[model samples]
Target: MTASLPVAPDARQKPVIAVVGPTGTGKSDLAIALAQRLGGECINADSMQFYRGMDIGTAKLAEDEMGGVPHHLLDILDVTDEASVAVFQRQARELFDEVRARGNYPILVGGSGLYVRAALDHLEFPDTDPAVRARLEAELQERGRGVLHARLAELDPASAQRVNDDRRLVRALEVIEVTGRPFSSFMPVRQYVQPAIQIGLNGPRELLHERLHQRVVKMAEVGLLNEVAELETRGLRQGKTASRAIGYREFLKVLDSQRGVLQEEYSVADAITDTVVATRQFARRQITWFSADERVRWIDFTDPASLSHALRAVTDA
Candidate 1:
């Protein structure tokens, strides 16, 4: 909102383009190319990539991989620090505005459903009570996800239907208990805080499946296990949020095999398989969430035409 900064004349009044879709769909690559064409910098909205030592597991790009484009909000949190959508909403908006004010474009890129919306939409987060959250989380651990999910189903069926994970279900229950409103009621209206465009990348399900499978295999082959082991030394296991990331958690279980603590037998290949399956499922959920938004201009990630399509969406917007 400051008027002191020099705005580029070529910069349209309000242009923040968000590139989104499922994992393994090359959202980052598209964002980089889009940034190149638009003279923008990317701001990461991926929650896992916030951790400093979580590069390989999160599929973070190396500097050369970034194609000389600057990025923001990456590796800003320690593995032990909890990541919050509310906090990211505040920070990412600041970054977005700062980039835009100085005449550069702000390209928001990530598949983290809530963070992307939190930064660009008119969404507000209710305050949290740690005591209430702790109690609900304890209940979840003791009684299991099914019991808590059923309780949520009774209290707020719509929100319960949206989330099947234990942690998210617990958060929804906590929100409902604290605010006396269904979590789904907090869904943002189809309005942006600023003039913005959203582009989504999608491909055939079979292609996505293969892409994710191959990506997981590459991560495993390229020392994802070693990365997890090093993070364990830095307290990765103690962080409630980072400890549960898909690939990291699966590899952590494999790390547990180092001790005799695990009762079941497993291998690195089994860990890879679990990661691939979980990633595919996660991608499905992401697609479901993004597809519901009618405003997004979607492009096929497998098609070269999508580059031109995405470019047109930005230019026309």
Candidate 2:
């Protein structure tokens, strides 16, 4: 792997293209087609998609959608285990190396900007402190995740801007508390990686919102509620990272209602509606994150012709 990384000076490095965008942007279909045509294999970068038995909500790729192209790092972790960005970077880098060894282009595909960027840049985060984590978790239990957000806002406003009002903020505070440095300050810069193009999918905000609504509806019809129920059987609580996932958290309300845990009469339909709204907000954040990356070649997904042109640019590059 080391020998292959620095073989030539002027010649373009074998591209490790990344297909990154917000959810419901058709990234999976485009990635499969791109892999088929470009001699590429996909490396999943979505954090939630890493969990086993988490298909419907994560929009996991079906067997038929793969189109005979090999995929890596999907459904590899049990819900009981935590998959961190540092862990993802290590495993995904190995897969990237293996793909390059097989003489195939590697495509990192997902909406998880942190995972994608960390893997591409070969980031190595500082070791975590269990003591800090314990304290943070205790604070979360006593107060709430909003307490961690307030702490992050005080400690590192830049990192807080990237984090939503959930586990992301909690993780940011954890990193800060453990490392004694702001999370944003310790970010690994791009180094010792392949030279390649990046592409981000885009659509009109209104159209994207509509797509998200339709997506949540289709997911409900396809048994998203049942999927969450199965996870509940495994003791997936709201405090875990897997439970904080958009679809999982929303359905949890309905699951509690059925379990006689919550007093309110929350229906599955209500959960589905909440999931749609949360997913739209998530998609907006994803777009904002990708826009920060100046190297990304953005394409309007609402127009098929624009996608064709974007693909041409990718091939031409």
Top candidate, metric TM-score: 1
* Candidate 1 TM-score versus the reference: 0.84
Whole-model lDDT values for every prediction:
0.89, 0.81
Q: Which parts of model 1 have CA positions greater than 4 angstroms off?
A: 1-12, 131-185
lDDT of 2 by residue, 98-209 (tens): 7776777788899998998888875668767778777777888899877778778899999988887565666778887677888888766765366666778888888888
lDDT of 1 by residue, 15-85 (tens): 89899989999999999998888788999989999999899989999999999999989999888999999
List clash counts for every candidate, in order: 0, 0
Steric clash pairs (candidate 2): none
Per-residue error for 63 in candidate 1, Å, reads 0.7
Q: Report the Cα RMSD per candidate.
A: 4.4, 5.1
Q: Over 4 Å off in model 2, which ranges?
A: 1-12, 131-185, 190-192
